[model samples]
Target: MIVVVEGISAAGKTTWCHQNAAQFLIKESYPEKRPDRQAGPGEAARIWTDWNAKRWSDAVAMERAQGVAVCDTDPLKLHFIWAMWQIGEVAESHWTAQLKFTRQALQDQRLGFADHYLFKKIDPDVAQAQKDHDAARSRPNFDLHLRLHASLVVWYETIEKVLSGRLNWELSETLPAAEHTPNPYRYDVSVFDRFIQMLPRPRR
Candidate 1:
């Protein structure tokens, strides 16, 4: 199974995935893309074009090996991030089409990317790091800022919908604080132990 573990940038997903590697083949949605790049002109489009191709190939190979792939991110969030950054309208037909393409690709590859939902959660440190990085950059483009905010909004909504509908598999965590409070490291010792206990039995 391709278990995709995603959350806001600093949501401890990396740590969680590493600890549970025996149960999953962890990966980020688009690992090849550079975060420091300026998001403007044709950069986003070009990146997506390359991303889709390589991602499809990588996914197919992983599935063929019957590997338990746990991706850190998925193309869904990447495109959503881009759409938020540049297009400004996720509901637009073109954006919808791109999202559908991603969905279809996952299905075609038989790489089941599990959407583990965590709602109303954003890692404060991660957000701050991004903001600081952007500010320090010699020429931070405006489009990137747009996408950053948009991606955050979309991330919250996307997780909320998944949780509400129970579309993906469920993994519970003991939130350190209320939804509004900042719980960057929400998955502490107790939550981590719970996650470990819930790991699926290995496939034959």
Candidate 2:
């Protein structure tokens, strides 16, 4: 099973993966120098397209060997592209080429989509606090981060529709809604269990 834990920065994806003892990989762990903003838009998009395809291929290999793998973000680069565009970092003319690249990668089976997508929803205040406390790394401004997060949610919703019958997707939530206040900051273990249960069986 290949599961993706996705959300805005400071959404606790890495933390949840750690607390649950899942076989986890974080995107930042594989650091590549991204093309500078001054780079031509087409060049930057192409670079990220290739990088994301490779990342997805690597995760698929891990899942094949280990029976399970969890990624801290979606291997598809669509969300990244969307974020860059939202922040006016990418030229509009590059959109078509980038989308084409992503589609071709999927058709070629070079970039495997997640079997399940778990979207973490945290309170804005909590997320902001987490960002503020992380002094070592520079993060996007809070408003920009929020905008990116919203766009990601919409993107995943579209993915769910596109991948209907092929994949499972869910938001972090506890059962029996009346029993307790939903803690937006963390995912319940039940969410993990649900993912495991929904995994497709291997062929003989």
Candidate 3:
């Protein structure tokens, strides 16, 4: 089983994962520092494409060994791509390339769609308060983060719609199934593809 905890910055994603002590897979940190400046068009796409591919590989490997995995973020990097586009840090071609790669990863099962997604839904005021508390990390554009959070909420809803009966939807952190219940529906590439395509374009 693989579960993904998702939200905007300071939305308590990392904190929940830590508190649960699940096999937390985090992609934000790299052994080396990332390129500070935005890369030219396709370059940025290529970098993230490869980065997510590796993330998928690592997560799968862990699951194979441990039987369960919990991720701080999804390997699709949906929010990251949208946020970058909103900030004008990436071009359409870059987003296109990344989306293509994401589609391929889903199709190939290199990255399995998360069995469950836990979204930390909070009011805008609460989100702002959390952001302010985490002052050590620079969030120069709070509004952009808020918009990204809204976008992700919509995307997750679309995913649930596409998966419909197949997905076990749970808004809170509570487990969706009992210990004895069988999980009949597995990852469906077609449903996942539709979910990916349904993601809204970043507002300019």
Best by lDDT: 3
What RMSD does model 1 have?
Answer: 13.4
TM-score versus the correct structure, for each prediction:
0.45, 0.71, 0.76
lDDT of 3 by residue, 56-159 (tens): 67766766786656677777675577556655666667667666766676666665666666777777888788888887878676677776766666766776
Candidate 3 — which pairs collide?
none
RMSD to the true structure for each prediction, in A, is 13.4, 11.4, 3.7
- Each prediction's number of clashing residue pairs: 8, 0, 0
Q: Could you give candidate 1's per-residue lDDT for residues 1-204 as a string of tens digits?
A: 334445444445555666655344436545455532333423444456457546545644664575444455553344343435344443334443444444444445422223233322444556456546654443234345334544554544544443343223322342112223222322243432343234322222
The lDDT of each candidate is 0.42, 0.60, 0.64
Error of 2 at 202 (Å): 41
Checking candidate 2 for backbone clashes, the offending pairs are none
Quote model 3's TM-score.
0.76
Q: How accurate locally is residue 112 in candidate 1, as Cα lDDT from 0 to 100? A: 26
Better of 2 and 3 by TM-score: 3
Model 2, range 40-147, lDDT digits (tens) per residue? Answer: 766766777788777787777776776556676777756666555655656656655676666666656666556666777667888889888887757756567676
For model 2 the local lDDT of residue 187 reads 26
Global lDDT for candidate 2?
Answer: 0.60
Candidate 1 residues lying further than 4 Å off, grouped into runs, are: 29-44, 79-83, 86-120, 123-204
